[model samples]
Target chain A: MIEALFAAVLGGLLLLGLHRKVIARVQQRPGPPVWQEVLHTLKFSFKSTWVPETASPGLFVGIVLVAIGIWTAALAVVLAGGSILIIFGVYMLHKIVEHGFGLSSGSPYGKFGAVRSVISAASEIPLFVSVAAIAVFTGSLAISDIVAYQAVNGPLLIIAPPAAFAMYLVILSKMPFSPFAIVEGKELVSGYKTEHFGVWRAGLEVANAIKTSVLLGLFLLLFLGPLSPFAFVVAIVILLVSLSFVCAVTPMLAPFDSVTIQALVTVVMLGYLVLLGVIP
Target chain B: MSSLGGAPWYILEFGDELVYFTPYTTTLLILALVFTVLALVSRPERQVEALFGTDAIYAKDTTVDQMRFRRFMAIACGCASMGAVVTGDLFNFTLFVALVGITNVGIVAAVKNRHVQNAAFQYGLVALTATVPLFAGAGIVAATTGTLSIVALASGTVPQAPFFARALLCLGVVGEGMAPFYAAKAEMFRAPGAPYVIMCSLSSLLIFLRVAEVVMVI
Candidate 1:
């Protein structure tokens, strides 16, 4: 367990550095330094938190902590080989907490962002199911078992290619790439993160970087399986390349009605049957 | 789990192959793609694209957020289903499926779109119809194929299900297919659609009841 946690933290740092470089390359401009995320976090920690007068100060402080806590918990759960069920539940809790904080801001944009966050939370269900199906096939909820299953079964992904693709889509949404980048997709002038500035803003950015890494980790576990330390590093590079390609080609999506989310999931569920012939 | 070894977790002994889940996954992936396409199609309706393409990116604000939330919820529901698939515990699978069905309805209700009320209601009714087929099919498949163990089915240890289970499953699927068009009806009514929201909530409860009936039996 300790080993897994160590790997996750180390991998997370690397992901942050990789993210900066990827952003720089995509914009065709010089970006922040690779270790910028770490420096920003340290600076934010030392600064005083400025609570908005109308905001729920108690909730405000709690919200930032909740975001950090959830991200950390996700790291822990995925590392400890906890059941996918527990991991997902914790993820949902983190999302809800973040949304609650947004709503508590009392700004119209904040409130709007909060509602949007709720919508995003709802969309995560199908993604969760796709992972669960892999667990079911692998016959273990543990992340380690998933890796082991791949080692033994020659990778369940080849057998369940459609599910893998679906998982990729889920990751895309979770990662907030273009099109599905619903929450904080610049429409609300940064969506839920709008009111935040200074240290709080930095925290939000760091948290987002953490989220991006987590999603990548999930994608690797589900599709790529167990890898040597070297392979893992290579996979990270490949993932960034793909994400950049997605960024370059696809644009962000417009916010339609929330019901469209349900329809989208239903369609995905249907596709799972048509393409994979998997009937869970 | 204990039957497979200390490595019980490593054995995917369930009768079904990994391929069984493909349909659902494909459905989600393709739908997401279709949605992106639709949004692109809608872009011409507005005036002027921005330099950052912000307008194109953040198109239908409410729908995008809601879809993201749905994906998260699906993960939870699917996790529960994994329990069912691994253990061949139809009861467990049913429970998780029910939870998802109910929650989905609740979300629709929460939206409270009047224009989509009838649609939501009809869609809810269709989902409810699946419960019966699911039960009937399971029973028939069990009787004819003479294999009652869900674990066996999942692991591919058993032959195909009997006619009944398959028939019911098909029927349930057919019923579920009718959900969408009517679902958006409530969304059309008010500025944002209140009736659809009420209906969605009502259906959530209804789905719970329906899923409960089948899952309890398994």
Candidate 2:
């Protein structure tokens, strides 16, 4: 379990770095190496760190721990083949963690970021629609059950294309530099992360790494079902590269447009779900 | 929690309430506990605001009296969320969900900012109105299925809840402050208490998660 977690963190960082590289290459620029994020986490960790003067010191510090704690628990859930509802729950909680990151520091930029996080909360609804679609097809929320269903039937990707697309959009929204990531928009100076520096920021990086791994892994688990270890790596890389291409071609949307697009996608997904006769 | 080391698990049940933890509710309860402790220990941050035209920035302190009230509301919100997650009864779940919305408003209403006050008022209205559907959904389940017990409902012993009841329950949760129409809920985040303000979002998420599970089971 420990080794799996360590690999997940390192592998996830490399994937994120690769995501950056993919975007940079598509944009006609040389990007940092795939190990850059791993190094970035280390660099931040060794830097001097302290709670900000204007902050609630307890929450300022505690939220980072909570952020990491929740994701770590998420990793455990995925590994245990637990209910996918827990993964959805963790994704939602990550928003509050971002909000906490912004508001705990009392920085105007962070506050704006936190507010954007809340406003952009509408974008998360696609995830629920996708989950519902999956639950409809598989008739279960547990990961093991989902895998069993896929094995007996076929990949949900082929069976439920619209559901897959909805999920793809949901994952796209969370990938760094994706059009919908308004919470960390450049204008807010790293947005919710503006005020978290040094070790606190490093802790957050660890959490993000875990989150990236868990979400991507979950997508594979839900759509393609179980795979051998090597196949899992190959699958997630293909998945990440596809997501990167989407991120590369798109411009970060104005917040309202981002929310509107996600909402519309959710409505369309829900319509498909209705057609499935899962929803009434 | 079922097994400290992955042993085969048995669900632990409490007395007549039949309250129990599935892996889902256990996670929710842990989250509520974490944030409740955060509210208990964390002071509200002194919000820093800048004078728009100039370089001047000042930090506004949260008042003692307001802190006390928001803290109390935050804990109440947390407890409501915890209850919502663990309750085995649909009626109790609605009651707990309703308390979560009311306490969410209380958590921010004392901020003394006009923007926050206005938003909270609007949010409170929606939250209060949300209960009508919430209770009506539970009421319908009771009327149609002849029971409000989720355990019994999920047991497949009773008649299945109607499609409208399930839809109403979901709609009520969304109205309780789930997104796509959370304009007032977003505005209420402008309230200055980080720990307290967080419970508002957390409670909504918890209730939403719980409702999804409930709707599926029943």
Candidate 3:
């Protein structure tokens, strides 16, 4: 479990670096080294962390701890092959973390970001739909059971391609430069993250990296099933490259537009689910 | 048997029926307790100053009353959420759900802003209307199965309910402010105090979770 946590944190940072490089290449500009995120984290960790006078000190600290805790729990669940329902629950609870992160600071930008976060929660419905589709196909909600089912019946992607695609979009929203990055868009001056700095910002960055790894790992587990260590790394890299490509090409959507697109995707996924007989 | 590791711990007896503690309820109870403690210790965000002008005149005694009421509502909301989770009787569960609704409204009712009050009123209307289905579902189950005991239902002593009753029960809980109805409730969170406002969301979530279990079991 600890190894999985370490791998997720480190691999996630590397993936972020790769994503930045890919975006830079797409824009025809020089980019930082692939180790840039690692250096950024190290620098932030070494700096002095302070509470903003305008913020509630307790909630400011608590939100960061909650973010780290949730991501840690999420990685542990994936590594331990626990129930997927727990993962979905954790995903939903993340809304609270975002809300707390913004509200605790009492900044207008942070509050706007928090409101966007609430609006963006509509995206999670599609994830629940995807999970339900998988549950229907596997006859269980446990990650291990789903993996075992895939071993016998082959990858669920063949059976539920649209659900997989919908999940891909959901995962895409979590990555930087995606249309759904409204919460931390340039206009909001980094949105909910505007108030956090130094060590606290470092913690948020690390937690975010772990979250990225977990989402990709979960996608792999659900769609591709468990693979050998070599195959797993290859699959993760391939998915990251695809995500980077999407991030490079797509302009960020307006907040309402992002919600509309997700809602449409969810509607289409629900139609696919109906066709697959996952939903009646 | 006194207790089993994964089995429900029988806490009370009413003739052939039993009230018991299961892992599901225990987990929610612990969560409610933790949130309750946080509410007690956390400071208010003093949102009134932000929403209204500093020159805005407000009576000091009324502000004090609002704070006191908000605290009471927060604690009540937590207790109601805990009750909704821990109670083993289906009828009692419905009662706790109703209490949660009232207290959720209470939590934000003290906010001085007209928007907050109006939102609370809208939520209160929905919550009030939702009770018909909540109690009606319970009544239907009792009528069909001859028992309102969750243990009896889970143990298969009672007959499974028709689809309508289950659907109604789910609708009632969801109407208490899940996704579709969340718009009405979201405005309530705009009220200043974070600790107390959080209780509104927490109670709704806890009750919704408990209802899923209750619907599945009964």
TM-scores for all predictions: 0.58, 0.96, 0.85
Which candidate do you rate higher for lDDT, 1 or 2? 2
CAPRI class assigned to model 1: incorrect
Per-residue lDDT over A1-280 for candidate 1, one digit per residue giving the tens place of the 0 to 100 score? 4565445555555566666567567878787777766676667767776866445444445456556555666666566555454455444444444454454455556555555654444454465457545744776556777878888777666877756766666565655444566776776777667666667766665556566667677677767788887887788778866765575466776555433664577467656654543444
Q: Which residue pairs clash within candidate 2?
A: none
DockQ (C-alpha based) per candidate is 0.05, 0.52, 0.22
Expressed as tens digits, the lDDT of each residue in A1-280 for candidate 3 is 7777888899999989988998888878898899899899999999988876556566778778878887898787777676665566566666667767776766667767776776676677688668767766786666888899999989988978877887898888888887788888989888878878899989988998898899988999999986998998899989988988888888999987888878888778868767877433
- Say which prediction, candidate 2 or candidate 3, comes out ahead on DockQ: 2
Give the per-residue lDDT of model 2 (tens digit) for B112-181: 8899899989888888888889899999999999998887888788889998999999889887855467
**Predictions in order: lDDT:** 0.49, 0.87, 0.76
lDDT of 2 by residue, A192-219 (tens): 9999999999999999999999989999
Docking class of 3: incorrect
Model 2 — TM-score against the truth? Answer: 0.96
Residue B179 in model 2: lDDT: 46
Better candidate number, 1 or 3, judged by lDDT: 3
Q: What's model 1's lDDT at B54?
A: 52
Best by DockQ: 2
Candidate 2: misplaced stretches above 4 Å?
B1-16
Best by lDDT: 2
